[model samples]
Target chain A: MTSSFLWTLRSFKHFVNGSSICQAGPVEKRGRGRRPAAQVRGEILDAAGKLLLDEGMGAFTIERVAAEAGASKTTIYKWWASKGALALDGYFHAVESTLAFPDTGDIERDLLTQIRAFARLLTRTRAGRVIAELIGQAQTDEDLAAALLEHYSGPRRQLAVAAMERARERGELAAGVDFEVVVDQLWGACYHRLLLPNLPITEKFATSLVRNVLRGIRA
Target chain B: MTSSFLWTLRSFKHFVNGSSICQAGPVEKRGRGRRPAAQVRGEILDAAGKLLLDEGMGAFTIERVAAEAGASKTTIYKWWASKGALALDGYFHAVESTLAFPDTGDIERDLLTQIRAFARLLTRTRAGRVIAELIGQAQTDEDLAAALLEHYSGPRRQLAVAAMERARERGELAAGVDFEVVVDQLWGACYHRLLLPNLPITEKFATSLVRNVLRGIRA
Candidate 1:
């Protein structure tokens, strides 16, 4: 077998091993061999994400994703039940690994660190805009909206709340303070910045927000 | 001339006297009577807002809105420069008259009152979903986004901040507290709740949010 064929065979084996479907390989030679399923899946997701970012969410369609990814429609449908699900998966996966909460044990430091990191990621990435658009689309498209809330918003809010709870346990929060509301306040700033687009979410803003929340909540 | 025509004549005289566009009157009985410009304008705006709420931002078009409103396309073009402009005007005018800052004079009570009122409005109106969708579209559509921020977010933020400042001036807020951050935190909670559909913005949630922020910020 040719080198490209051998490479495709190896990648396919890795995919079957349940590795992430995004591992890149040497470009396949024409007529050399079939592309690996994993490679094809990654291409589709990449194309979908690009289309979402470049053309807005309205441009994301199964046919377009298939054409751009050089994959068959059947291939994509086999993985995702619907186009919105695929779009959500593609959008979520792209940013999933980056969702981190700080645990510096200093409530002020931790909150500021987390907020700034999130702000930077959101403002800097094409994925950020795509996610925002998807959330907006969810308002009208019930299925997409439900999937987003379940897969995206629920987890993120839980994470933030958990962080606040940890701070409360550490006595960083004042007695009788509501952890849920504190989390909302932190998250609300981020959402307002994203949705409003008036103020730049600068480091200063993030730092001040963390400090203010801590000062207000600290026992 | 029919009574409708006479009525149109009287309405046009009234509009001229009031220095407003002569746009309202009964439709010409035989399709040859003068239609008041202001009536046509209001009809167009009403149609545009309805379309935006029902069909998402993409369905907004001069021709479509004119047809839906029973006005001519020429009439629409004469009023607004573009579809985005028309949509913007429709959205702003729909919500503008209802806008107000809570002035209960107590910071916590006022903030909570304002949030509760807004939450009720958002949940009650079809326009709420349309506004959310427009904000999303604005992220990609530069002009729409700019208009939204300038006309909507800017004023809203200003109102919130002003309320906080008033609280500080009245000694309801802790000395040296970062007022801007406090505003961001509160505003962020409401915006996040709107965008993220997982957490229902129930009255309890709104009340709890206010209570927590007040607890955190109170001297």
Candidate 2:
């Protein structure tokens, strides 16, 4: 296997927007008579993802992944340092396939689309349960929190922040709108509803939310 | 012990803001030998709080509370239907003593005070950990979620909404502000930081948060 194969293990976004790097593209292979490392890595992530979907976070264990993937514990550890790392990789793989960043050029509409999609994902999918489990786990587990922040949340927030910056340049947003605060309020509202489940996170709610916040930010 | 002793068991917030019925002179006794039910109730709550503080949610059991309070199982069951109910009472007892509603008459300042106090309670107290435990538990436990919504989150949210309504009536808020959305954003930001611990929910942050949202809502 080429270094790119190892790179696949290290980097996510293997597939996006109707195209998959894992297929329909050239893969650099350097070895003969041995399966490519990329294939092994893909198998591991698939097993991890299945385990998460099947039994939720409670049953997500590195040892269990080893058994499910028919690989040794050392082999699993060599690829991913801990269960948190492995589970995150699996989570990203799941989330990326299902959700897309909105870029409709209309900032308010884009935000509505993005947040509504997010709310739906958290409330409607099996992945929501897994995300909730990890969030609860992250409260006390510093290591898991760090991994999730670095891999999952950080990239997602960057995308949203970039969208806001683009809107500012387009004169869609006011001169002194703090994107961080706006982003926090938007995302935080959805998260609060998810955690509490006392309020409904309907599409209408998302639309009203974006409109209300944008009223202040719009020039 | 008179029926007034039993009344103490049924009522919460018996007193607030410096005047407490519990400590406002002695009561006339109607029974000769029975212990005060209020004292018994206090012992149970204290024991439950201690268990939550010393060991955490895992060790918080009704059986354990019975042992800790030196009360019989039947007696404990007579008051609370489940561990969640008992723990919630303990949590409320802790929270009520420490936090107070903000009524500074300045809408922005009132919000800042309320949210800052909330952030401090969640970050600086042992009850914070217990609350986190209950939030996580609520994700899976339907019954617990209902009880928390009714007893804890519902009332807390009502107070916040009332504050926003007061602001609107004072013409400090815009014509069409949704108090629920605003309340969600303010409280949610703090909760998001609490769960993730990636961001600081400092006093400055709380002040900034209230100011930012209020900018959107101000007339």
Candidate 3:
């Protein structure tokens, strides 16, 4: 159900461009003289991203976003039901280009490479703070929490799961190893370090982490 | 340095009670009569905790807390330097009684017991949401982040470290076991489950977690 919600949101962009007609059957425009829906959505996301990056969560109000985007409240609401949805949309839009999972033959090597890259993305870039803010605020906001689980966290987790399954099939994992638990420890340590700021999530840290967990679960 | 800061805060209560005279050596009052400093501090913490619990972070402003506590902003600032410090204080004040690290002879059992209790505190109680808010806001507020590490996370981590060191001394752990890494994997997994909310962090999950990590590191 949560995954479907995320899928609907992703497909919304396609639907807006008249490429898909599954849910809500696209938005109807008032006049033919209006700008393209995609352009408007892009502007909104651009404004939202800038607001989040520049000012953090304190300035991420819908009213301010609308003002920044030069769009009306009705126009923004026509696409996103809440501020959380819009913020998540802004997040996915910002990171989709760089968010890739590795699939090298060696699961350990692949995991280490990917985790190191992700650690940098999470700690070195603005995306890290932005993502942490969304995660933090997601605690109190149910809609945001659901949206984050569905859109942001779900896809990445699915990739990790698939990779673990492939490793298991190749007899690379210990007997009775739970891929879910493996992924949790791998990704969880990264997030914990990011949020708690007690440890540095460096490439060395990532390598040692992958080595430790792999040693624990290796066949 | 942060540990010292936490110690200072803890001693603040004693200083306010006219029982200890270290550091600043107590506050000097003006005029003839005044309320007990300890009671005033308690009132402030009570008001802050209530605001954080009842309304969440949106309403947890120093101005509002002062109004709720019927104390001046100056009075609140005299003890706490910022909102983050105050919020963490409130969290510690509220949960100090319930949060205890287990030290059973078996490291695995002790870890599972303590982690399960912590997972519950993070998910089943108001403390979960309160903590999430602090972590969320801590992303942008550096002061709050430091206080959280020093006051809330530091002591618990020390307890876990001590327990692991004891285990290693007993030869219950593998040679060259890194207790820091072990604690990270243990607590990080729980925090990951808490923040992502993708999986339920139950007792069974904790059991499996402790067993798996112990399998890797046990002698």
Tens-place lDDT digits, model 1, residues A167-211: 778876766666666667876677777767788767787777766
Docking class of 2: incorrect
DockQ of 3: 0.23
**Which one wins by DockQ: 1 or 3?**
1
For each of the candidates, what fraction of the native contacts does it recover?
Answer: 0.54, 0.30, 0.41
- Relative to the unseen true structure, what is the C-alpha lDDT of residue B195 in candidate 2, on a scale of 0 to 100? 71
Candidate 3 lDDT, tens digit per residue, B44-96? 78888767656655567889888877778887877776675676566576566
lDDT of 2 at A151: 63
TM-score of each: 0.62, 0.65, 0.63
How high a TM-score does candidate 1 get? 0.62
Clashing pairs in 2: none
Question: What's the iRMSD of model 3?
Answer: 4.1
Best by lDDT: 3
**Docking band of candidate 3:** acceptable
Ranking by lDDT: 3, 2, 1
- Provide the clashing-pair count of each candidate structure: 11, 0, 0
lDDT of 1: 0.63
Residue B39 accuracy (lDDT) in model 2: 73
